[model samples]
Target chain A: MQFKYDLEGGNFSRAGHASSEVKKILKQLNVDARIIKRIVVALYEGEVNVVAHAHKGVVMVDIDEKRIYIRIEDEGPGIPDINLAMQEGFSTASASVREMGFGAGMGLPNIKKNTDQLNIESEVGKGTVLEMTTMISS
Target chain B: MKISEIVDVLNARVVCGSDKLNTEVRYAFASDLMSDVLTLDTENLMLVTGLANLQVIRTAEMADIFCVVFVRDKKATPEMKKIAEENNIVILESPYSMFRAVSVLHDCGLQPVY
Candidate 1:
């Protein structure tokens, strides 16, 4: 099964909509709790990243018997240094965003920690696209 | 420990999931940072946070946390309560500050996730 959802930048109010929906779908499929937790953690972090940094974003999820895949594409000021952004404490978020309990700079690291496979592509003036996959069966 | 015991000890109000008071949680972690909360990889956990937002509920859901204790008299909004109900996660509003509440719970034998 596959699903898609749109996300608005700076819309902290609705940041986790897509992740929550995907969680329900995973539950309905009786996916293993450990696998589902990893996916939800990664996907929710991705969703928050879009809301915090992008102009807007889209999440695409594909699940089958063996794997669950997620593609997140966002239009924003793309990261100039993916390596720097991947650092655990590196952050560009403002104080206001931090007060809301986000922007702690652990987003990307957490995503990488939870996903089985991850690929990131970006252009400084354009946007970023992240592809993450997790094996669900076997 | 049973969530009901927390209510009694912390003088917390059950914002939702009153029926789930009987639900038991083994670990308690307190943090306002949702990212820190996300990294938790355990079962039957309770999160004590000062953040009262949709994201808090979402974090708990994603992390598979069983109960949330909102410190410093924070209460969940209607939307947050609605989603918490759907997910069967308990929400408790405590009158105590984060430190006092966490200390009390720890003294009451609630184990730490660390």
Candidate 2:
């Protein structure tokens, strides 16, 4: 099964809408509880990243018997250094975003931690694409 | 600890999802940062946060956290409560600070999610 959702930039109110919907789909499919949790964590983090940093973004989710694949593409100021961006204490979020209890620099790391496979590609001044995959079965 | 018990201990106000007050939670974590809350791996943990935004409830929902206690007397908006109601997650507002909320809940037999 596949699903697609659009995310708006700086729209904190709608940040988790996609993740929550994906979670329900996973539950209805009877994916393992542990696997669903991991996917939810990673998907939510990725969803929030787009909301916090992009002009707009798209989330594409594909699930099958073996693995669940997610791809998030955003039109934003791409990360200058993917290595630094992956670091735990690095973030470029504005103060207003921080005041809402986010932009603590843990978003990317949390996504990487929960997903078994993560690929991040970005070009400065252009955009970013994140692809994450996790096995549906333990 | 039951959600009802946490309410009593913290003198909190149940904003919504009163039907879930009898749910039992084994651990509690307090953080104003939603990112920090996402990294938690424990099961049946309740969140204590001062953030009253929509993301707090959304994060709790994604993490399978059944209850959230807003510390420092912060109250959630009606829209956030609506989301919690749909997700079946209980929302509680406490007058205590985050530190005091954690201390009180810990003393009341709620383990940390570390």
Candidate 3:
């Protein structure tokens, strides 16, 4: 099955809406609880990254019998240094974003830790795309 | 510990999901950073944070945390409380600081989410 959700930038109120919806779907599908938690955490962090940095973004999910694949594509200032961005405690978020208790530089690293596979592609002037996958088996 | 016990210990007020005050939580994590809370490995944990925004509830929802205690008299907005109610996650407002809340809960036998 495939699912898609749109993300609005700078909308803190709706930051985790997509993640919550996807979690409900996973629960309805009876996906393993552990896998569902992994997916939700990664997706939630990805969603917040988009809201904090991008103008807009899209979250796409492809679920099969064994795994779930997620791709988050956002339009905004892309990462200039993926390596630095991956480091914990490194963030370029605005002060307002930091006030919300995010931008502690833990989003991407947490996503990486929770997902079985992660790939990031970006252009400094254009945008970013984050792809992640986690196994759904018990 | 039972959520009710936590409420009593921290002198917290239930902002929503009052019916769930009896929910059992094995662990507690106190943080102002949602990112730190995201890295927690276990479920059935309660989050004690000073963050009063909707994302706090959202983070708790994503991590499968059963309850949230907003320390230092921080309060969640009505909208946040509504979301918590919908998700069956309890929201509690505490008068104690984050540090004191954790210590009290710890002394009362709730393990830390390490």
Candidate 4:
């Protein structure tokens, strides 16, 4: 199964809708709690990153029996240095984002920690595409 | 600590999931940073934050947090409340500041998850 959500840039109010829905769907499907938690965390972090930094984006979630995949594509000022951005304390978020309890520079790191696989592709001025997957254990 | 006691200590208004008042919270984490809460391996935890948004409830749901308390009179929107309800998360609104709320809960035996 697959689900998609359009993430509105700078719209903190609607940021986690996709992730929440994913959680519900996983629960209804009786996925393991630990696996569901990992998917929710990874997807939510990606969602927030798109909202905070991108112009706008789409989150596409694909679920299979063995693994769950999430692809977040955003049209934004893409990361200049992917390595630096992956660091735990590196963030370019404005003060407003920090005030809302985000932009702590842990977004990328948290997403990486929660998922079994992660790939990020970006250009300085074009956009970013984040592909993450978590395997389900039998 | 029972979620109902935490509500009483903070003098908070229950916004949703009142049926979960009897839920036992073993540890508490107070942070406005949702990512920090995500990194912590806490189960049956209580989240105290001034941040009011749908994501807070979403974070709580993912982390298996038992309850969320909004400090400093932070009011949640109707949509946020609805999401909390859907997640079966206990929501409370308190006039107490974050520091005070944490202190009250700490004094009453709620320790941080570290």
Candidate 5:
């Protein structure tokens, strides 16, 4: 099955809606709780990153019997340094985003931690695309 | 600890999901940073935070947390309550500060997860 959602940038309130919907779908599909949790965490962190940093974006979730795939594409001013941005304690979110209880710099690290495979492609002046996959244990 | 006991200990009001007061919680975690909460392995714990937003409920759901206690009398919006109710997550509002709320729960035998 495939699911997609539009992510509005700078809207902290709606950040995790996509992830939440995906979690609900995973639950209904009887996916293992552990795998569901992993997917939720990774997708949620990515969703927050898109909202906090991007201009606007879309989240696409593809689920199969063997694995779940997530792709977040944003048309924002992309990251300048993927390595530095992947560090656990690095973030560029504004004070307002911080006040909403995000931007702790753990977004990318958490995303990386929960997924079996991860890839990030971006251009400094154009946009970013984050792809992550978590395998389902038989 | 039962959610009812947590409410009594922290003097917290049920903001939503009152039917879940009988739910049991094994550990507790207190943090305002949603990212830290996500990274922490807090299964079946009650989250205590002063932050009031829809994302708080989302964090609790992602972590499989059963309950959330908003410390310092933080008010949750109707939308937050709606989301918590949908997730079957018990929501409580405590007038006590985060420190005092944690201390009260600790005194009542609710241990924190390090």
Candidate 6:
């Protein structure tokens, strides 16, 4: 199965809408609870990252027999340095984003920790694309 | 611990999911950072946070944490409460600071998830 959801850049209110929907679908499909948690965490962080940094983004989800795949593509000021951005405590979040308890520089690291396979593609001043995959079966 | 017990111990108000006060939670993780909360892997975990926002409920929903205790009397907005109710996650607003709430829960034998 496949699904897509759009997200506005600065809309914190709607940040996790897509993640919540995907979680419901996974549960209805009887995905393992542990695996579902992993998928949702990664996806939620991805969704938050887009809301925090990008102008706008789209989330795509694909579920197969063995694994679940997700892609988040956003139009925004892309990460200039992927290595530095992956560090645990680095952030360029605005004060408003920080007030909501995000932009702690932990989102990508959390995403990497929860997902089995991850890839990030970005171009400075242009956009970013994040792809993640997690095994659905134990 | 039962969710009701947490409500009593922290002198918290149930912002939503009143019917789930009897829900049992064995572990608790406290943090304001949603990223840290997202990295958690466990069963029956309750998140203790200072920020009462939409993402807090969203984080709990994504992490499969059915209970969240908002420390320092932070209020959850109506929208947050509504979404939390739909997700079957209890929202507790406590007057205690994060440190005090965690200590109280710890003294009551709530196991830490570290």
Q: Judged by TM-score, which candidate is best?
A: 1
Which residue segments of model 2 deviate by more than 4 Å? none
Task: Name the regions of candidate 5 deviating beyond 4 angstroms.
Answer: none
Candidate 1 lDDT over B1-114, as tens digits, reads 899999999999998899989887789999999889988787889999999988999899899997999999988999999999989889999999999999999999999988
Could you give candidate 2's per-residue lDDT for residues A1-138 as a string of tens digits? Answer: 899999999898999999999999999989987789999989999988988899999999999988999999999999999999999989999998888788999999999999999999998778899999999975
Tell me the tens digit of each residue's lDDT in model 4 across B2-97.
888988888999999888888888788988898799887666688999988777887887787868899999998998788788778889999998
Error of model 3, residue A55, in angstroms: 0.7
Query: Could you give candidate 5's per-residue lDDT for residues B1-114 as a string of tens digits?
Result: 889998888888998888778887888999999989999765778899999988888888887887889999999899888888888888899999999998888888877888
Model 1 TM: 0.98
Can you tell me which runs of candidate 1 are displaced by over 4 Å?
Answer: none
lDDT comparing candidate 1 with the true structure:
0.92
- Model 4, A21-117: lDDT tens digits are 8988898888988888888988888988998899999999899888888999999999999999999999999997887778889999989999999
Clashing pairs for model 2 are none
Every model: iRMSD: 0.8, 0.7, 0.6, 1.4, 0.9, 0.9
- Each prediction's TM-score against the native? 0.98, 0.97, 0.96, 0.95, 0.97, 0.95
lDDT of 4 at A108: 94
Any residue pairs clashing in model 3, and if so which? none
True contacts kept of each: 0.79, 0.90, 0.88, 0.64, 0.76, 0.86
Q: Flag clash pairs in model 5.
A: none
**Model 4 chain A: worst 10 consecutive residues (lDDT sum):** A95-104
Between candidates 1 and 6, the one scoring higher on lDDT is 1
Docking class of 6: high
- Local error of candidate 4 at A129, Å? 0.8
> Which runs in model 4 stand beyond 4 Å of their true positions?
none
- Distance from true location, Cα of A104 in model 4, Å: 0.7
Better of 1 and 5 by DockQ: 1
State which candidate, 5 or 6, has the greater DockQ: 6
